[model samples]
Target: MLLQLDIFNILIQGGKGLKPLAYRMRPQKIEDIVGQQHLVGPGKIIDRMVKARLLSSMILYGPPGTGKTSIASAIAGSTKYAFRTLNAATDSKKDLEIVAEEAKMSGTVVLMLDEIHRLTKPKQDFLLPHLEKGSIILIGATTENPYISINPAIRSRTQIYEVKPLTEEDIKQAIDRALADTENGLGKMNIELSSEAMTHLTQATHGDLRSTLNALELAAKSTAPDTKDGKVHIDLAIVEECLQKKALVQDKDGDAHYDVISAFQKSIRGSDTDAALHYLARLLEAGDLISVNRRLLTIAYEDVGLANPAAAARTVSAVTAAEKIGLPEARIPLANAVIELSISPKSNSAISAIDAAIADVRQGNYGDVPDTLKDAHYKGAEKLGHGTDYKFPHDFPHDWVKQTYLPAKIKERQYYHAKENGRIEQAFKKQYDLLRQAQRK
Candidate 1:
């Protein structure tokens, strides 16, 4: 009992002592949490779960600095569970075994696993039984999407929730909490942050609360108090010194990756050069050249199809060059491809026409092949009237004789609705219409 009391005292003292500001100011309760309103706001899913003490195996996925681990910790605190933390990058199977053993003795253990995506397959397999038996309520936290990075067996056992970046107001509330709470924050310190300093840190961190807190801590700890007032004044200059260039929130393997690629293709289709280039740069910076190549080729064929065949051909060449040259230098050719495709005339008619025909076929609309259209190369094909009405188009002017090519059911169905966007497709529309007219006559 004395030993337990001593450990508890030490924990209490630690919160008031030399822990980093970010560590000290972590929310201990759900209400104390400053962001992730969608998860913890009034009547939110997480709020209800924690309130009912019904914590289960959950995977929290989001960008860095979005309180995933903190929320897990808060849930454990709220539910009065024995909290245990582990880093999948460093902890091994033995560590998991120890945690599971402890949970067997304790009522419940809230195991918050950081970078759960990095958990080895063996370790994840080991954790499966513990999770099923409820010995440990696993709270897996990762910046990567669990569906993509986690083993299927493990992902199937957990509920996945996405925690997005905090809003500016939420971040500000967090900062205020840190400054006002004397027990676990910088409230005890005589420090005053200028308005400009607040704005600088808030804007520069780009919704990353950890980054904001760390910068605030650095400026607080390093700056000396003014001799006149005996208070540390954190100004814009100090903020500038502490703030580094923050990259945009991007998950190369998660939903953001697909979202960015989708936007890039749409931008090209809509002829928005600037937006297309922006998304191109994002992919390049993330070193996702493979996705870049695939998305660019898809855009070329799907969006730029039939409208500008030259652009389509050029996009293929650019992808080849990108593959040959590789990144850093490769982004140049990729950017050129994106720009060219963005400005090129857009057309979905070709794909739409094929898809319409395919849909009909899928719905049991298969029609018999026209006797004239059927091949007569077989020994007995002539006896079946296969080539009886077949016209040799080469024997006519323009190598174009009116003939029934389509299946009889869809022979006259207008499938190809050409959009007059570019010169090539325009010329194609005229010639194609003339051919249809000739066949009707």
Candidate 2:
């Protein structure tokens, strides 16, 4: 009991009266690092590189909170070389040159540059020559696609390692560790995490460890004073208030923008109106105009095709209205369009049928156009009888001719198969069946 009290006191005082809780939780060795065992696992590429002291210039590309910075720090810690850090967002070309001169004078240097994609072309070029000479080993971290954002020359020299987002298991383990750690964590508080709270935090964070930790920290602090019998029960209501409502919502320009939009599309596809509306509200709150417009356009065809052909037309009209009206007034039409398309019945194979037919023709399944449909306007057309077998549909009953329109090679091919659900497609099916039946007789 006394030992536990001392541990709690030490944690409350912030780790030997020096390091804070966040710093105390920082991994000291590579093995202590969580979530990225694939890269730093025993005998893996990174482990082999570190063991052999053959660390190459490399880029760590992944979404935020997947341990890119931590891995780079671990590499530097494990190495005998001097370590230096800089942010490309604030550091200039001169700053890089200064580091280069120091590296030349002081022997090997490992320069870990955060947000390397933010560096200008010249700044990136400044590091190229030094990198080639082995005076400095570059470790760059970026959230963007490196091929499009990084300098091509710099990219060619450096090896790229992609870090994946942490799994739900990873996030759960991290939270548990934070709660149990005596130093720099809520060691003294017996905080109970409700299942709903845990699930909500995991989903809301979108695989960001930093955000998750911050959220847990906030939740604990907020619930600390409300404890009873040395146990604080954190319910869904507490989590929703402390984390969800004030969590900065997901910004369209921010890191989780793509994730939120993907969730929105999936919700509509799954026919979950509640989930779809939640994402819609997030996007609308963020003021993401182009993304909203683009998604509405896709939803029109992908989710509302043929069922209500007017949905696509309405979506296009909404886009035009958005352009002319521009927000406040435009938001109304956009919201209406999104709701209309989301709730509307859906069909997809209408477009897929045409695509399949084209593929068949390209593969030589259909060799040529029918003789009746061939051009007869040329000078020598009379001798070849291009239009000789043609029968005008107007001359037949119901303005339709009982004839084969397909080429000889693919005369029996049937590409389109209409769905029986939508009203629009039913009409097409009736007319098509009648025409084919008459042609057969």
Candidate 3:
């Protein structure tokens, strides 16, 4: 037991010896944490919890490098809890069993479960009982939404806190801390980062502190020292070369994926052409052509139904052209389709009419089909008085005939109410009103 304790201490205290700068610069205490001020600032719930040593099981959710794991480690440091880290993707259920056993022996254990959304059902089942008994203080970290991706049973037992992306100043603060700290940072070595380099690095990382630190470390390590002063000078050129290109933070299967698509559909539905095109660009940049295509097609039928029926055919053509040409070129046709849909007159009457009719049917309002409208082409259908009084519209002027198409119970029921959203629907509405007037006459 003493040997195990010694090993644990070594693992926790081994930050100074050779390790990644990001890992070494991890905040050891709550005050050292750079971002997430909402949860951990003075008088905040997490801060109060840590100060009082009354931490609870929590799942920290956010984008990558937003300090979920670091916050958990900080909590363990501040609360003096026995902290054990495990990778939910690689670690098996047996590892959790071991942690639970350790918690029993140690009285309490703060288990930092990284990528916890990947944890299997059996593993989660194992942890729940322990979580209820207060034996395991689980800190589940996930980049995806806990409500969407996490097991409901597990999520219900943990308080979920969303860790927001770090701001430029917050990231700069972290960069400065890493550069000046003599113990874990590169302060011993003389390194001067230019103002332009600082701005470029901070902005290029897109609020990801881990990427910023890693880029700083790369800039410091890769650059040769000046011969005269023996100091490393990181300029814009050096930072740019080290950082490469900025990456878009989009998860193909996560909340970001749904968010962009949702915004795209809403933009088109709301008739914001600029917003629609902007979201379309985002989807194209993220290489999510399928969602772009599927959503545009849905908008045509769902939002623009009957108002501009031609838009549906045009959208299908656009999708086919995009699929055939395949990206880069595909974005052109897709953009055209998005613009057309956004500007088209919007109406939902077709869908609403069908839905209202279906509701009445579901409520047991349906009756037998009218004899005139029933199938009359069969040999014995005529004997059943089907189509006996049916009037062919071809025999009447304007191909119009007013007759009871619905059952006697709902003979006067009207479902479709056309809107004058476009010229096509306007003409239909005019003809509909004339037909009703003629029927009254």
**For each candidate, what TM-score against the reference?**
0.61, 0.58, 0.59
lDDT of the structure predicted as candidate 3: 0.83
Candidate 2 least-lDDT 10 residues: 1-10
**Preferred candidate (lDDT higher): 2 or 3:** 3
What is the C-alpha RMSD, rounded to one decimal, of candidate 1?
Answer: 11.9
List runs of model 2 lying over 4 Å from the truth. 1-24, 41-44, 93-98, 188-190, 222-228, 231-238, 244-279, 282-340, 343-345, 350-441
- Each model's lDDT comes to 0.82, 0.75, 0.83
Q: Kindly report which residue pairs in candidate 2 clash with one another.
A: 21-184
**Residue 400 lDDT (model 3):** 85
lDDT of 1: 0.82
Per-residue alpha-carbon lDDT of candidate 3 for residues 336-377, written as tens digits (9 for 90 to 100): 899999999988888988998999899988889989988889
Best by TM-score: 1
Lowest-scoring 10 consecutive residues by lDDT in candidate 3? Answer: 1-10
Which lDDT value does model 2 have at 199?
65
Ranking by lDDT: 3, 1, 2
Question: In candidate 2, how many Å is residue 55 off?
Answer: 1.9
